[model samples]
Target: MKQGQHKQTDPDPAAHVSAGSLQGYKGLTPALLTKLAKLGISNMQGLLLHMPLRYVDETRITAVRDLRSGEQAQVQGEVVHVEVQYRPRKVLICRLNDQSGQLVLRFLHFYPSQLASLKEGKQIRALGEVRSGFFGWEMVHPQYRVVGDETEVATALTPVYPTTAGLSQAVIRKWIAWALSHADLSDTLPASVSQSLNLPSFAQSLACLHHPAPEADLASLESREHPAWQRLAFEELLAQQLSMRRHYARRKHQGAPALKPSKTLITALLKSLPFALTQAQQKVALEIGRDLEKPYPMQRLLQGDVGSGKTIVAAMAAMQAIEQGWQAAIMAPTEILAEQHYQKMQGWLAPLGIQVAWLAGSQGKKQRREMLAAIADGQAQLVIGTHALFQEQVVFQRLALAIVDEQHRFGVQQRLSLRQKGGQPHQLMMSATPIPRTLSMSYFADLDVSVIDELPPGRTPIVTRLISDARRDEVLERVQDACMQGRQAYWVCPLIEESEALQLQTVTDTYETLQQSFPHLKVGLVHGRMKPAEKQTVMAAFSAGETQLLVATTVIEVGVDVPNASLMVIEHAERMGLSQLHQLRGRVGRGAAKSSCILLYQDGKLSEMARARLKTIYESTDGFVIAQADLAQRGPGEFMGIRQSGVPMLKIADLERDHELLEAARELAERWLETEPVLVDKHLARWLGHAEELVKV
Candidate 1:
């Protein structure tokens, strides 16, 4: 066999057992298999699904004389001269001659084997950008291959695949080609559905994407917008949608405690609140109420912008469960957030004669035991805690509802564990950081989503400003002025302690400096490194108005409600993510008083992305818009904090770019589920290797 070529073999009968089974592949060592596994390629289907990262257009080779400077060109030539020279640097130069002209191939670093392969009279094909070097026309470190004959030159666009260490692109391409030739390429989608959507067959799409014709649209292929690309992207998205629909169907079959909407507690709690619920909140509350009343388990996602009153909506849902003689639990990601929820819930529910209990990792043995007993005995009508609530010792008498705050921070397994505490409980997952529509459709498809689109009445919009740290004294004067007026303020530092490497302001150092600068005002410090107790104490002081200025880190970004704090100064805001900056800005503006947020950054030191993030934060207060921009800038994986392991790894579909296809696929999946439910298993088995595991999200 020639290099980068694989012989076509007959399809193995056992290949039908597993779509991409590697059992039939020959000459693969255990070490190579291990490396391939690390790249998530275990079988023939896996290899086929690994799409090319890019394509090299070598369909028509350009002669040396026809090559233009700054243009990528490929040429077939015979090596005429080869030498190693040490002038300004040690370099190897090989001269090649074609029918029309001669060109020079220069390599700053070359192995002995490479030098040996470039001996005189050897025929080679080189592809690279032509540059005007010291020689007439030179290509530095071009991709070159030894050719047995002129016919071996490529006649189609060459695929460049993503490979792991110890694996070459050629090897991956060869294996993928082999798999393509031998593996079954049967149509997974129904003929009626494909025809309605104007989609090509699976085999046709894969062939076009992996090996396009010489006249294929290079731009379309590169941008992943060609008809063939769309066909594959749609199929991948449909597979995911099918998996989600299946999971949803399975959950719908499970029985859950049908909690009644007891208006007694809900009415009492609402009457006690100083403000009335917003229209959006009322609408979502009704949705949640309806979901809780269903016999089947409710899997719902509640998304609201920061300070959008999600907690009140959650509290209302919990009250319904409590009124129905069942326990309710709320789980938060961090201890601080859990404590905040505990305090808020206690204040709200205690007046209604409903007992609210708190459990945290920081609790002592006696307190933890008491809390656990309260939960198990149903004495604690509503339980609020962190991951400690998921521990084996913590059991609920009848957990009718589980409210998870900051849902993205917790994985699917943690949510499952909490649900398992009792008969499948109606889960209400809350996220203050609004997700883009594309993400919500693909990642949260299994759950019904309700968004709180309106802010409460009498809430003031936060005025955001972008200023340089060079104006530090000006910012400090503003803070002092606000503090003098009896208004609390927050000065957030990105770092807890000053590091010589970063040179950014630290929480501790800023606290000391602010104390020294304004000797009359009290200042408190809080950071992640501080003990839970200490952090809570400092936070309490700030919330109680005992501290006029609080120096802290991002720990105070979420669930810290202080209406009196009208000023927010985020130092080194450029270092923060878009959603995070929005959250920090949300800390203020909760009161009716006019609030201002000052984003402090070092002058002229921001990267393009950082600059764009700060600009977006300054220009927009809409969380959904900010989230969309963040997704576009940082991608879904980083924006969601690497929790993508639970979601399907989409090979071709782009959440940002291919949102239309996602919607189409989702609608199609729903239709198929309603019409041909039996075929879902067969479709998923063909497209998704482990449909059960992939649908857990």
Candidate 2:
């Protein structure tokens, strides 16, 4: 057979056997199979994929006398004595002696069968952390296996697997070995591709990883950089890239309304703007314009830093839809953001005789009825709302474009539902949280990305300061001084209500305190728990400058743009995510005046992770750098909110460490898709368990 090609032979009967069949295997019981199911090992393939987290080096057994104080070692000796002591927490002590010296095996908890197995004069192989004990050098809870007189002592690394309470490493390894022996171990990748990449066959990689030779580099295996690990990671990344490329290709075949370039409304709106569009904004707007003009539906991600004027670019795209005699809709994650978009859209388009409608879940029956009717009749040229716009009852006359703001907050299904509402309308997703390059390439392979890398000129740079909470009084006094200077400020709390468990400051308590401190000044509050109308009212007051200070939760993190607000003080800033803190800081520095952000962390010792987060924020103002740091700290899943961002779950690939493999896989996938589209399904099936579900995103 070839290097990657599978042999053409009859399928092995064991290929069809499920993991539950393992109950018939030599040690596993029915109850144990049920326990294994909880770990997602339901079939033979699942068991194979449950790779070891790490390995124990038992290649060379060490003598008992040669053991160090704090080193993990493996030793083989004859059991000299075994006893169960009642005192000192019901201890079970077994002493083993070799030619060099004697070692004690202390088991704080053990079964009667374990005592029987460790009988006197039984030769046992023990592996564990060696530590100094009261008696002598000992190993607590060491993994020991009895050896018979004729049994061979192999010099091979031991695989340590992730297990639940009822399962043991020995049992898991035994079952895995049984499954591997019976498995057909077919080659998944084609010979040509594998040879070009110099990657091992799927079966070969699995075998090497499961049973690494003693000569294998231990450091490479531990760091997951061995050839076997690299092969698996590359295959996983290639599968994802293939799925995304298929999705991208499939969308190209779907028909959409080809919107023409806006000549009248867009020209007038641009002219009417108080300031000129930045070069970056103009470039992105043109990219979006070209995408809108295509017959195929446009799936593009518009990424810009906070206060980078992404909203205007979206407005320009919406205008293209309206000018072509079709309605446009913009969806935000929250009501405050939706209302903010609504107000901005109305201000820009209402003057051009465009009808803008607002539809949120909190709208009254009569108001919603009017808005729905206008949308259906095509009278509302542009509509701005939250997820409520995608409701079944809310029908659009002809939605030519659907722009989703902060797209990560919405799930793939929710966004797809909106697209299905209007015969595959052109979609534009916007994110103010600038995604790192590696993440954008992997997570958003299906969409064409346009980045607004430059901020619009004339915006003031915000000065970031990390202050301990012990200086709360000093910070509060500074806030008062800023308010007295006729400037606005935002005092953000992490929680809306005081949690006795967390002991963090609450928005309500902070509002009251600020209110009392500045009795003459107006204070506004907004949070997720507030009614939509009430929240809108408070936000309106804040924007109108009716309130000099807004004490609220992170609900004001995005979409509440007040250029005059020059001060941002986040209490318990350590509790907030890095991206969120950047967004909150972005609220200021929007105006010409100099701005300052005070990160008030709790006094005393903070975790190393928290301190790192604060230090990263303080050292950099670049969103891309901060995003990379956040990805490093929180990982791809949490940083992008995996489910919401529609990032496919990678089983083996690490986006941070395996970036080179990802790049190679992307190139190979693209080349394969271009040259041989017919084999794509086979490639996907071999690696991707749910390619169909991932493509829908």
Quantify all predictions' global Cα lDDT against the true fold.
Answer: 0.86, 0.86
Candidate 2 per-residue lDDT over residues 339-415, each given as its tens digit: 99999989998889999999999999999999999999999989899999879998998988999999989888889
Model 1: lowest-lDDT 10 consecutive positions: 1-10
Candidate 1, residue 185: CA error in Å?
Answer: 1.1
Model 2 gets an lDDT of: 0.86
lDDT, model 1, position 135: 73
- For model 2, the superposed segments whose C-alpha errors exceed 4 Å read 1-44, 86-88, 112-123, 184-186, 190-198, 690-693
TM-score of candidate 1 relative to the true fold: 0.95
RMSD (CA, Å), each prediction: 2.6, 5.1
Deviating ranges (above 4 Å) for candidate 1 = 1-20, 497-502, 642-645, 693-697
Structural similarity to truth (TM-score) of each candidate: 0.95, 0.92
Give one digit per residue, the lDDT tens place, for model 1 in 1-697.
1234343343343444347457544455677678789888887678888888788888777888898999998888999999999998999999999989899999999888888788899888888999998779999989887776746556668888878887777777777877787777888777886787787888988898899888989899989888888888888898889887778888878899888887699999999998899999999999999999999989898999988999999999998998989999999988888999989989999989989999998989999999999998889999999999989999898889999898888877787788889868899989888988898888777889999998988889999999999999999999999999989999999987668998887788888899999999998988899889998998889889999999988988889999999999999999999999998999999999899999999998999999999999999999999999999998887787545447776778899778888988999898888887667766777677655446453
